[model samples]
Target: MADPLPTSLPQDTAPPPPGIGQLFLGFLSVAVVAFGGVLPIARRALVERHRWLTPDEFTELVGLAQFLPGPNIVNLSVIVGARFRGIPGALAAFLGLTAVPAVGVVLAGMVFSRYGDVTAVADMLAGLAAAAAGLVLAMAARMAEPLWRRPQAHAILIALLAFVGIVATPVSLPVLMLTLGPVSILLAWWAQRGRP
Candidate 1:
């Protein structure tokens, strides 16, 4: 007999979401092409190429990293690493993603600092900033698609609350996770607990 509910099992798990090699290679590729726009590409690479993190997992990782110290990319690598292979994976991702980029930045900053005040550099920075903003907007739309489809009012309300909470103050994401995330889940759990 066929299972009543359909499930989407992952296709590959041999090397894990991010294999050891992908740790370096994936970040390196994103870094080179990312330029002023990386969020979408990074999402695709992780969710599609390496399968390091699912779309939902990727968003949580991005949000978690945004609140932590260091660069967003560095934080992202750590989260991806942790998810992919536990502590060792996190370590591998951190070293792989940040090492080369850090070295390159040091070298480039040395050269670029001398010409940092150049008009060309300013224009490039401006362009890149615009690109980053667009990338972020796209990510928002992509993330909200499924949420809009879900037929749960409480879930939607929780999301709206999260959105408002995030914008209303300098609230730490950890706090929001602690307060709202679980409460929302618990509310649903409680609501259904008495259902036959």
Candidate 2:
């Protein structure tokens, strides 16, 4: 008889390590063109272009990044870079990701400090902020697709609870993290226990 399909999802195979030069140039490209946010571009490069991480892996990495203290993309760069090439990889990714943006921000700051008070400049800045927010929201929706495909309902519930816990309620982030983090893990584990 043919063997039955496994109940649990198969673990993704790790791909070959990208060289430090590729890491630097990939992040440099992401940094240069990413206007509203870097996460989307980073995802495209790491998961889609290079095939370094699968979609599910990318989502998990992003989740871990969100829980950490640093900026999400920065933390992601460090984790992904280190995963592929250790500390030197981490440094290369971090520097490549931030270097150009840092310079741009400094120059923008200099100009804004001079012209920011103007009504036209203020309006333009407001528009940019709105556009950035939209980009982030769109990226979030795209990332949520993997979770939406899971068989368990609690996966979606946990996500909704997290959203409401942070946005609708007055509860602090640290408290929510402490409370929800374990609960989510336990639920996932419980759901997976029935699988072969």
Candidate 3:
């Protein structure tokens, strides 16, 4: 008789790392499909569809990307690409993510310059803005879901503190990052040290 099928695959059997072409095409598809915000779709593609990064990994990279100089998603693409195949991968992903969008923006600018005053154009822009906000919220919830499932109270506390500090108080982003970023890192280190 044939051996019974295994219930679970071994940890060593993780999916093979994606090629540079795959990275380029993946980000290209994300750019094409995402209407108002690319991050939500990017997260879905990277974490769920491609399985290129886990939810926690995506959250961590995005967190780091936010503190970088340029746009967060751009930085994320570069980082993700570099993590896999160094500079070439980064270049491919960056081009795929920005090439189409950059052209679209130029065309859109010309159209808006001509018809910007039209009521329909204004309404459409407003609707796009609202949709962008909703996409951001949805992405936030998905990123937080993994943290909620895990026992990471310190991380949650830090998140809440950052939220309150930004919304309720006058602290700026730099101040919060400088102060709380190290604290969170230390707490994470402490938590990890307890493990075997």
Top TM-score hit: 3
What is the TM-score of candidate 2? 0.89
Q: What would the per-residue lDDT of candidate 3 be over residues 1-196, giving only the tens digit for each residue?
A: 9999999877546577989999999999999998888899999999888889988899999999987778899999999999999999999999989999999999999999999999999999999999999999998888788777985878988889988998999888888888898899998999889889
| lDDT (C-alpha, whole model) for all candidates | 0.74, 0.88, 0.90
TM-score of each predicted structure versus truth: 0.70, 0.89, 0.89
For residues 1-196, write the lDDT of model 1, one tens digit per residue: 9768747555754344557666767877776666556677788788777666767777667766766766777889877777767888788777876666678789889977898799998898789799889998897787666567655667678778888888997888679767886778787797688579
| Residue pairs whose backbone atoms clash in candidate 3 | none
Clash count (model 3, backbone only): 0
Better of 1 and 2 by lDDT: 2
Give candidate 1's error at residue 101 in angstroms.
2.4
Q: Which stretches of candidate 1 lie over 4 Å from their true place?
A: 1-18, 63-72, 166-196
Error of 3 at 84 (Å): 0.5
Descending-TM-score candidate ranking:
3, 2, 1
Candidate 2 shows a clash count of 0
